[model samples]
Target: MYIVILNLTDKKADAPAHMADHNAWIAQGFEDGVFLVVGSLKPQGGGAILAVAEDITDLEARVAADPFVSKGIATPHIQQIAPARTDARLSFLKDVA
Candidate 1:
């Protein structure tokens, strides 16, 4: 599992220009079953993505392809997590450990 943070950068104002493409990229992530969750970061800090992938390279490549990254509208920081345990509803996350 990974937590991908799209932290806003100096070019944040350019976001609206790339939003449609960014949204398309997000949709592709979901359609591909890589992104488990995605949403805003409070107070206009950009966004975050919860993703799971078998290969870190694949995940890095995916993040690299986000419009926000390509356009320099945000910077990405990927944090890997090995799920040791989870609540009953989220037990599936443990498989990625």
Candidate 2:
């Protein structure tokens, strides 16, 4: 799994121009069964996406394709996590092993 952080490099006000494409990109992630969660970074600084991929390289390439990154509106920071434990409700994550 990966924690993908999108930190705004430009003004949040400039986001609207690329918002549609950005949203479409996110929607595609969900359709592809990669994105587990997607939401803002609080205070509206940017956004974050919880996703699953075969490897970090794949995830990085995926992140690179985001409109926010390609359009220079944001920078992506990706963290790879190997879950050793999880709540009962999230036991499914153990399958990633």
Candidate 3:
């Protein structure tokens, strides 16, 4: 799985314009079972998004085309996650055991 962290910089003001597109992407990701969850940082500083993908390349392409990235609303910091352990409620955890 990959975790994408977005930090808002120059285009914070453009958030509204890109919101619709952002939501659309998220919806599509959910339908495709790629996105896990997304939320903004406290005090509205920036945002964070978590996604599970087969590989980094696929995740990169998706992030590159994200509305926030496309519109320069936020810069993304992506990382590969290795889950040593997870709650039993997580779907991925089921596969692990």
Candidate 4:
């Protein structure tokens, strides 16, 4: 799984131009089953996206095509994680072994 963190460098005023396209990309990502979860950081400074894919190449390609990236509204810092353990508080991991 690849964890992509998108830091919004631009101001909120510039969000509108990229919001629509960003939402569309997210919607498509859901349909394609590559997106795990996406949400904004506290105080709306930026946002983070979690994705699980076959490889970094695929993840990179998809993120590179995002509207925010294309418009320079955001930049992504991607990381590869190995899930060591999880608590039951997370519903999604309740049944995961």
lDDT of 3 by residue, 62-96 (tens): 88888988888889999877777777677574352
lDDT of 2 by residue, 44-93 (tens): 68999989998788888889998889888899999888898999999998
> Where is model 4 poorest over a 10-residue stretch in terms of lDDT?
88-97
What lDDT score is found at residue 43 in candidate 3? Answer: 83
Misplaced by over 4 Å in model 1 are none
Question: 2 or 4: which has the higher TM-score?
Answer: 2
Give per-residue lDDT, candidate 2, residue 65.
Answer: 94
Count clashing pairs, candidate 4.
Answer: 0
Give the candidates in order of TM-score, highest first: 1, 2, 3, 4
> Model 4, stretches more than 4 Å misplaced?
89-97
- lDDT value for candidate 4? 0.80
State the lDDT at 45 in candidate 3: 76
- Per-residue lDDT of 4-96 in model 1, one digit per residue for the tens? 999999999999999999999999999999999999999877999999898989999999999999889999999999888789999888885
TM-score of 2: 0.92
Rank by lDDT, highest first: 1, 2, 3, 4
What lDDT score belongs to each candidate, Candidate 1 first? 0.93, 0.89, 0.81, 0.80
Residue 7 CA error for candidate 3 (Å)? 0.5
Per-prediction TM-score to the true structure, in the order listed: 0.94, 0.92, 0.86, 0.84
Off by over 4 Å in 3: 94-97
RMSD of each: 1.2, 1.3, 2.3, 2.8
